[model samples]
Target: MNTKQSRIRRSRKTRAKIAAVKAIRLSINRTNSHIYAQIISADGGTVMTSVSSNDKEMRAQLPNGGNVGAATVVGKRLAEKAKGLGIEKVAFEAAREGGLVF
Candidate 1:
């Protein structure tokens, strides 16, 4: 009915679609002051890897974590972590309302 409700409905449908695929997911969340990325297991019970602009290391490197540059940094960090864990591929799940269901 309202915008927030519509966004929630869209996100719910997206989550259902993701679950049906049974594949690892790379989810991204961007807020006003931070960016976060996560790798989730197929069943969504496990978080394989995660990185955020709020991390201590990232915080030091990025004085301002609200911009696109900060988001890119978070994304790259997440990718590196995933690679180290041998996660070569995943389904991209961009949150309609800014977070994954899990």
Candidate 2:
């Protein structure tokens, strides 16, 4: 298969592993111009908390949220929100063609 298809294959395996663990998940998504993160329940049915560069508060602090710095900011913000929502730890999930990160 080609590179894109190979990546998707890898990601599907990763997601299947995550699903098997049946733990809360910290899902992250990064695009060319923004980063987003969310804390989902063990069954992945509930969103406990979420944060993104698109948020008004984060947007005001960042001129643009496309780089690693923006990812870090979104990660920290999401962590805080999750903590406030009583979430202390989680597994990580990613898209079918992506990888997980802290």
Candidate 3:
């Protein structure tokens, strides 16, 4: 199988396992120009909080959204939001091919 398909398959399996656990999901999506993160409810029906490098505040601070520095900022913001919502645990979900480094 090709790389893209393999990555998708891996991600699907990971998500399935996470669903079985019924834990809050910390999902990360990355693009060439931005990085996005969201914390989903335990039932996976609602997004409790989200942060992105493309956000207005982030964009104002960083000229480029697709960089390690931007990723750090996004991660910090996501953590702060999650803490405010009292989310202490989560199952991370990210594509295998280009997952978040931290």
Candidate 4:
């Protein structure tokens, strides 16, 4: 399989395992210009919270929304939102399956 297809296959498997345990997940997605983060329900049926560099508030504070600084802001914003929702724990999914750690 190609790189993109392989990554998808790996992520599906990892997500299946996480779903089996019904654990909240912290998912992140990075594009060429922006980074986005979200807290997803165990069943993957809903997104509990989300943050991204493209947000209006974030965009105003960050001169360049695609840099690491912007990503850091998004991450912190997501964490604060999760805490407010009473979500104290989450499994982090890296770029894709087998990417660094969970």
Off by over 4 Å in 1: 93-102
TM-score (all chains, Cα) for each model? 0.86, 0.84, 0.88, 0.85
The C-alpha stretches of model 4 lying farther than 4 A from their native spots are 94-102
Tens digits of lDDT, candidate 1, 1-102: 999999999888887888898988877788899888888999999999999999999999998998988987787777778778877777764432222222
Q: What is the lDDT of candidate 2?
A: 0.76
Per-residue lDDT over 1-102 for candidate 4, one digit per residue giving the tens place of the 0 to 100 score: 899999999999988888889998888889878888888998888999999888899988988877878887787787778778888778865443222224
Per lDDT, the best of the predicted structures is 3
**CA RMSD (A), model 4:** 4.5
lDDT of model 2 at position 81: 73
Q: Give me the displacement of residue 33 in model 2, in angstroms.
A: 0.4
Say what the RMSD of model 3 is. Answer: 4.5
Cα RMSD (Å) between model 2 and the true structure? 5.0
Q: Which residue pairs collide, candidate 3?
A: none
- Give the TM-score ranking, best first: 3, 1, 4, 2
lDDT of 3 by residue, 4-54 (tens): 999999989998988998988888888999999898888999999999999
User: Once model 2 is optimally superposed onto the true structure by TM-score, how far is the C-alpha of residue 7 displaced, in angstroms?
Assistant: 1.4
Off by over 4 Å in 2: 93-102
lDDT values of the candidates?
0.80, 0.76, 0.82, 0.80
In angstroms, give how far residue 102 of model 1 lies from its true place: 18
By lDDT, is 2 or 4 better?
Answer: 4
